[model samples]
Target: MMPQSFETFNNIVNSSPVLTDRFSALVQDTISAAREQHGVDLTIEDCTAIAELRNATLGATLDRDELDRQMLELSSLSDSKLKADIAAGDQEAMAVALQKVNAGKEVVHYERSSDDRARRISMARELGIATPPPVQDDLRSRAEKIELLQEVKNPAQRVALARKWGLL
Candidate 1:
């Protein structure tokens, strides 16, 4: 059985506007089935209430606008003007930037507490792309082949694509 005091989880499931009663009921039934299969001591009442909570969250997901807004807010906090301020060496900007950065960190901590490294590498990889490398390989023929392959439209065209791209 799931934890009794999954307060946030409860709130998410209960309060979502998009989750219909029927869908919520189905999810509750599924949870109950899993519990019963595992010999969990969950009561019918627990499933009913948890189903309501879960429904609320699921319902909210039906609205794409809300999801988009939330994604925008998250991205804004993580990779917005605040990061620029920090890069420019401004102390006041750095303070504000740190707050934005910390806010993003807090969200990540809560949402992905179980898989910390998963998000770290992705974020680092994205940020690394904007920074220029030390050298510019202008005369590299390998880079040209890779670029040509990237432009190819068909699967067959790409099937025989060469691997000679950059300094090996």
Candidate 2:
């Protein structure tokens, strides 16, 4: 048998994709505090994890907008891969491809931040920490591969991200 509240939370998460970290934190914090107040032996790790999840989810939402903007810039500046491939035999095409490949590569880096944010969110949530909505598990799961993912946007995000990655 599962805890009713836990199951309720799962259902809420599954159904809502727009819950923000602030909201999730409020919910989780309230529940955890209640549990603690009532004599449920909660550890520092548990409290830390929930706090981290809330922070990570919030960070991911903030980064998502920036990532989307960067991606748009990359798309506007880079030659389409298909066009580059078609022009492969032409020196001009090759040049274009090279330029696009280089330019787009930089823009592609936006994923690093987004991925980092996602990973932090996922890890925190998975550990029974509360998380905000708009959390992308795929991003979080593979965040380790991204170099820029570790950059913290704010003090809260920084602490949460560190805890999510076990850096703190």
Candidate 3:
């Protein structure tokens, strides 16, 4: 159950156009479901709780366009810094360049993962599922794979494992 008061819920919903739209679309259905399944007419508070649950269960709403815009800006900034560092032609600059490259890769990977999660959540909602899809496999991040590679004494075996994981 939502612990928030009706006024708090109203404030929240009013602050976000997305939430307002979602609440508007969901309220009637929520009320009907409560009446049919629970044999109780929902109060305004009850309806808000149901809407909040549905929203929360799916995941936070993301503005993909805004996220993409920010990512592009960050990538541009990183690339400029990396190029300048490489152009300096010093050992420290070279190390900084490598770090920048790794950081950029990490950011891109994170963005892609967030996109995948949002896609899965959207798909689940479309299929009328009440819960987000279960993760089916344990996947290691690139950094974890790199750390694991350091433990492998055989260089050839390390390369093979890296290739298998698409880290090469």
Candidate 4:
């Protein structure tokens, strides 16, 4: 079974405005499944926010019109009037080009989150891309390892366990 990351879950909500009550139930089920199967050690606060923000950024398509207006207002100025725009340096352009840059950043920030890497992985897998499995949850400690190894009597099993635990 594929794992759903918070990011992919957010995408599902954002992609559709008309979600059903069943979607909430599904999210809960996914949260349970991820916790059980994927070893995603999230704080309660993180889980709470993930449940809340599942739809929070849905309508967050940065106001491109406002950005364009800002740019147009800047462009309408005479080159001599705006010192920042005509400093004959790319840095100057960058300083004045904040409107588009900032809005584009908003789109990117909306599209992904550090907390959503799992969801992104899920999406990638859905697209038929190969994804590495989540790192295994190794619960064995040194003492536990020794205890486990003490029972290895068969030669083949010993070799297999040794290779698995890097004993050889």
TM-score, model 4 to reference: 0.19
The segments of candidate 2 whose C-alpha lies over 4 angstroms from its true place after superposition are: 3-9, 20-23, 35-39, 42-168
What digit string (tens of lDDT, one per residue) describes model 3 on residues 75-99?
Answer: 3333444444444545575565444
lDDT of each: 0.48, 0.44, 0.55, 0.45
**Predicted structure 1, TM vs. truth:** 0.24
TM-score per model over all chains? 0.24, 0.16, 0.27, 0.19
Q: Which is the winner by lDDT between candidate 2 and candidate 4? A: 4
Off by over 4 Å in 3: 1-6, 50-168
Which consecutive 10 residues in model 1 have the weakest lDDT in total? 67-76
Model 1, residue 29: distance off in Å is: 20
The whole-model C-alpha lDDT of candidate 2 against the native structure comes to 0.44
Candidate with better TM-score, 2 vs 4: 4
Model 4 regions more than 4 Å off:
1-137
Q: Give the deviation of candidate 4 from the true structure as CA RMSD.
A: 22.1
What lDDT score goes with residue 118 in model 3? 63
In model 4, how large is the Cα lDDT of residue 137? 34
Ten consecutive residues with minimal summed lDDT in candidate 2?
A: 70-79
Which pairs clash inside model 2?
A: 19-133, 118-140, 119-140
Model 3 residue 81 lDDT?
Answer: 41
- Which model scores highest in TM-score? 3
> Which residue pairs in model 4 clash with each other?
5-118, 5-119, 7-116, 8-119
